[model samples]
Target: MTSAPARTERSRTDGPAEPHRRRRMALALAAGGLVLGVGAIVTLAVWNDSEFATGTFGAGSFDLQGSTDGAAFTSDAAAPGKTLTFTLDADTLAPDDVVYAPFAVQLSDTSTNEAAVTIENVIGGTIGDDLTYSLFIEDDFGATCSAATPPAGAEVVADRAADATGTVDVFDLTAAGEPVSLCFVVTAGAIGQGEAGTITWEFAGTSGDTLP
Candidate 1:
């Protein structure tokens, strides 16, 4: 008899496409993981550079000294400074009488700049009305300051009454101990009988000394 043909068994090639799709997905996941690892490594890497800076500072000095005699110098930085070694009878002044005194000034060796000196005022005297004075600055070095006369190069600073107020004159001094010599000549102005007192003159000095 004519029997029916036996059914052929299903083969692997004839199965559903699900297994192929799963294999492709696994490969894609593996590639994504590799890319993530490379990105993390790049983020962790770093580069660096730098620089630095720094400074120093200091202060300067200034000091003034005086000499009553032209030889020995000292500081008289207070009111009623060094007493004058007058060449006349200063304690017994009379009409038309004249007296002389010498003084000196310099910047201390420790000073950093040159100086300017001014006659700020004259004070403390009842006899001032009858006393007129003159100040002279001399360029004569190594010579004794004298009341008889200043050096030929001497210049008069002021010829004011002893009680004159305000700035009357100005002078200069070199830096680091160069001395400027001065002579004072005071004259009596019709002084009264038995009228007497003392006077104080102010000598103010400053840095960058100049003359006018």
Candidate 2:
């Protein structure tokens, strides 16, 4: 009888063991591939660079003030500003009568910028219609508004009807607080004996490095 195919001892021993060894080798190779992918990703993350920047800042100040006596400076920013301390009978009225007052202007000591100042408006009440007025600048804080004629070398800023509007002159003040002395001369114009009222003058100042 034909004998069944021989099973060699080598075949029996190698068949199953060979398949198991191959599976273990394939698992080791797959783990090695995963480790290589993780290493490459980490290398990309480590190779990096960057940059940045920043800043700082601040501001300045401006102010204006007035003095009626040319000694004590203050702000009279609105209508009916500091009352003009006129010489002679300011309250009394006769034709051709005249009176004088002293005033001064300057930038405040702490002001950080220079200015251009103006006599922006003049308004009169009941007595305003019956008066004429003039503004003059003098060298000293003491006034010459009462002089029979404007003082020698005096500068006239305004000579107009008592009831007038708009700026008559523009003057300058340095940031270091230089002073400008002013004089007001008011004359009666046949006003009635019983007439009495108020007058207001407004000064406007603009802060700047150059005049505006």
Highest TM-score scorer: 2
List TM-scores for all candidates, in order. Answer: 0.74, 0.81
lDDT of 2 at 195: 79
Model 1, span 38-62: residue lDDT tens: 8888856579988877667665656
Backbone clashes per model, in order?
A: 2, 0
Q: Give the 10-residue window scoring lowest on summed lDDT in candidate 2.
A: 149-158
* Residue-level lDDT tens digits of model 2 in 1-212: 99999885775767799789999999999999999989888843466677877666555555677788788888767677788788777888787888887788888777777777777545445777888777777787764656554443255554577776667655778655677888877878878877777667777767778322
Q: What is the lDDT of residue 12 in candidate 1?
A: 81
Q: Itemize residue pairs with steric clashes in candidate 2.
A: none
lDDT of 1 at 122: 63
TM-score of 2: 0.81
